[model samples]
Target: MPDITTSAVAPTRLRIPRQRGQAPGTSPSGPILREHIDAMIDLHPGGLTWRRTFPGTLDHIPHARHFTRYLLADSDHRHDAELIAGELSANAVRHTASGRPHGTFIVEINRTTTTITIAVYDCGWGGVPRFGRLFGIDAEYGRGLTIVAALADQVGYEGAEEVGHRVWARMVQPSG
Candidate 1:
């Protein structure tokens, strides 16, 4: 996977485009969904991107899910997106340094006419994510990525342990 930690724009602040009649700092969907977003870059002229930073904690997993749900509400894959966000965010908090006090993780969603991608960025303490060998239904852990892969057309990650990691899952939209 490409290392995004070295990107020049990694430190830039994310900006949500306003609707024609919308006020500054407000979401078109509803009242301003306040978050500590730090960076976001458009994938392309035709794609849409939104991202937010959350303090890494198990309690914040629902916030990440809600973010995905709000963004993909109009799409057919909203449920999958929400699940993916929750799983990835949980992993970041449970496996990475982002779980430490004062640590943070980022949730980003990129959408195009044919695809939707959800990603979780962590502070890079844990090793890369992987799908462990199949576990029986009674296994207590180790199935998040497997579930994500089952729902996504593609699943992978970027960056390194020292810098950070962005675990992402992308789903292709169904034909009309």
Candidate 2:
């Protein structure tokens, strides 16, 4: 396992290219992005879990699912993490329509010898609940963050000024 530390500043934001048609299975752009994410996940102290971000569109869900499967198959499956990916994909589908310019979503995996951290960022208006009290236990509207919080060892949010926001979670890795 590797020791992990956060930089004083976040890593430089990379610009993800948006294609007009569906994403290519072997295109340079998509594979390049996937490699970057894989590298990040692999650097985790335990092992590379998975990290990815795609345009906030309905079409990206399949890509996300594929990536998640690829990552989980290499390790003990962490189904809780999948919930965050699903929520992010669902939000992207609900918010970003065809006429809208491409929106962005980012997923990062940070690892320490004993813990794994997952973070998701999106370029949408920041309106998701940061606190758990905002919704009822049975409320169907907004529970994604709540679920993330429940499943994670820790959970929080980071504001991106006027650009957007990020939701992050840290969870303990299952010991083999």
Best by lDDT: 1
**Count of clashing residue pairs in every prediction:** 0, 3
TM-score of each model, paired residue for residue: 0.74, 0.59
- Candidate 1 regions exceeding 4 Å error are 1-46
Across 1-176, the per-residue lDDT of candidate 2 in tens digits comes to: 89966555333233344557846543434223334444665675566545676777767766765555444433333466566556655654454331146666766665544566666666755455354657776777776656767777787777653665666777775542
Tell me the whole-model lDDT of each prediction, alpha carbons only: 0.83, 0.58
- Model 2 alpha-carbon miss at residue 141, Å: 1.3
lDDT of 1 at 98: 95
Q: What is the RMSD of candidate 1?
A: 11.7
Candidate 1 Cα deviation (angstroms), residue 156: 0.2
